[model samples]
Target chain A: MSDLQARGHEDWLDDVAVYALGAMPMQDAQRVRAHIAACEICRREYALLQPAVGALAESAEAFTPGNGPIVASPELKARIMRTVRPERPGAATVPQTDAPVRRSVAPRERPILWPVYLVAAACLAIALISSISDIMLSGQLKQSQAELAQLRSRTNALASALADRQAAISDVLAAGAKHYPVDNGEVVRSGSRLYIAMYDLAAPPRGHVYQAWTLPKGSKTMAPSLTFVPDAHGVAFVSLPAGAPETSAVAVSLEPEGGSKQPTTKPLIVVPLD
Target chain B: MTEDAVVLMERVRKRDADAFEALYDAYHRLAYGLAMRMLGDASTAEDVTQAVFVKVWSSPELFRTGNFGAWIARVTRNRALDVIRSRTVRAETDLPQALPESESVEDTAFARIDRELVRSALASLPDEQRRPIEMGFFEGVTHQEIARRTSTPLGTVKTRIRSGLRKLRAQLEMTVTT
Candidate 1:
């Protein structure tokens, strides 16, 4: 066992990697499990790695948009049928049927005014402002401007993220070097209809701020939708611009590390079409 | 097919404004919720859902096989993906670095219970184990990425994660059974 450690056992290590990736061959994995059964150290080791296996099942990066759950009602059916008929579009009506009477209508649906994100952002703005006011206040004018800049950039990224996923405008621009906007639906537009704008930061506000990029032509790879990704709630990263060859996409990450004038760092979240 | 929804749709096809309003009430939230999940954002979800119903009102024939719910889902998914594709953010990487920071603690907690318990558990793991697993899951990183990130040998990273997972599974199993 000490020899295993001394030799830095690649074979043992491979077993663990397999488990973590959830790509280990089953028989080999079983052998590893057997080894663990007989060895307390291995058991503890297995115990340690077990969490990783579990994590593999999680896809725990972020919120994936969900259908929520299934819920239906009799009145719902009755109401639906009332509204629903064999629909024929761009054609004449099938004529009115008998029993247009006793209709119970489900109200015209209004989107919930869940300003959950707005409220949360406000709270965070307050919290981070307190800590970074010096940076904000030192140049007070620039700071307020920076705040606006930051907000604008965030908003731009978020708006782009919310746009439809199949188009290639951003993806084409981002084929190499550039970051795309990310979608965040936290902001809600009111009225019966909601207008979603994909705000383009276009570029960073200042020399120090990050630059925005879009995906390049024929480079549109579908980023995970809400169904799978990290942090599906607050922000969702789509595809980043492919600024680097190692980079499949581009993004708009902040860089005190001052990544490439052209995004050396990962954007907080890749904007859609970036 | 709530009471009001039926009336609204019936009149909607008939192009009755009043009835469409009633129908909108019945399915708006459900539609939004479904769209939000599919689209992953409130605004896009709202847009997709609203567009869907408008399409519903204007042309109810959009729904095939009479499964309005599924139809709505398909439309929204296509629309949402369309929106995603058109926008700047791109790539489908499940990288840990992609998670947004805006989640409230409660949201994190709920996300755990609602999505996958194992993720929440992994989030709670000590930094050592958490880092490696995130590398693997998010980047599809081989032992190499973990080693590179952790600055340890590839073998060390692999050992830590493998053993680490065993412990995690036992913990999860214990908690679930209890």
Candidate 2:
């Protein structure tokens, strides 16, 4: 190694880590940024370690419904949808700018006629009434259309959710299905699909969730699976994302939101398939 | 699942409301959760969460490619950082850039592992190592500030951070491989 490389390993390596984390003070970080830009060894090390630092953001526990220090309210989603929905193409109304401009008649250019004024006033009254009636009908029509659209969206969502639940239920009852019972749940394997069905699960502590981990065959470390929150009825049925044939064991634990790479708490459930 | 997300994003680009909602339902927790952790207020967290998702809807094109979860997480963090900056008087320093566009095999593997795994890996670290790292990243404090809060020498803080990150990388690699 060159002298610069050797010295960097001794002097600047630690700074690279701090820099990667973006926790170095401004002046110190600037100096380190300059050095790493030139030093191949330190630069490579920074690149290697940066993802790990990025992964640190994932370490924060996420908010899960019913089991949270805080729940992300549904109103928040409504607020977001409210903001973006109007921005959708063809969703907003364009103001009419094509109405003809009327020129005022000069008293000298047009002879004053009382009967004509009276007729014009009558015409104006009829036009105003017609415009108001049209506006009221248009408003009702828009409101009805909006309600219908919302109903359609809800129906589609419900249909989709029902279909998914039905599929999971069918998989559980399929021939050759194997079931392993745990503390509050059962692991079901049907063909290549695996699922965890839990009942009467207490809500996780504030800012915590129940996360699953899979031990793939011949693997010592359990790979993290999905994080879930039981419904209001205290039930959850989650399909394992990976195939069951390759997984040897399944475990679940109460973890902070976002879950842990490893189980932080004792596994509440562990089932061995083989 | 990643492929599914890519497809969903394509739909989002097409102005599909259902597709956007699906993405939101899948990821809002991660976005809001990160915001809550950083901001420590439910109301502000909700606001930040809304802001992040709105940005996603407004500019799905900003995310050309890469891990959606990671990209969203970074966006949430950056948004929270702005709020945190507005709340404090600290000197502004540039945050680190997002993960490199062309990921190495290891980076791709790391991205494939979900947030829960990464959180578990962080949980596995010793408190001394984990605390400094958390303070630096989540709290957006500098090494000197971490040293002050944790009552360690600045040099020791830097060393601990390095040691902690290396250990974290090793743990994640093991998790990914296994």
Please report the candidate that would top lDDT against the real structure. 2
Q: After superposition, how far is residue A97 of candidate 2 from its true place, in Å?
A: 25
DockQ of each: 0.10, 0.21
**For candidate 1, lDDT tens digit of each residue in A222-270?**
2221111222112222333233332233334444323343445555555
Worst 10 residues of 2 chain B by lDDT: B97-106
TM-score per prediction, in order, is: 0.26, 0.53
Minimal lDDT window, size 10, model 1 chain A: A186-195
**Model 2 agreement with the true structure over A111-207: per-residue lDDT tens digits:** 5667978999999999999999999999999999999999999999997875565466546644357878675457888889888877568889999
Which residue runs of candidate 1 sit more than 4 Å off their true CA positions? A1-13, A19-274, B1-120
Candidate 1, TM-score vs. the true structure?
0.26
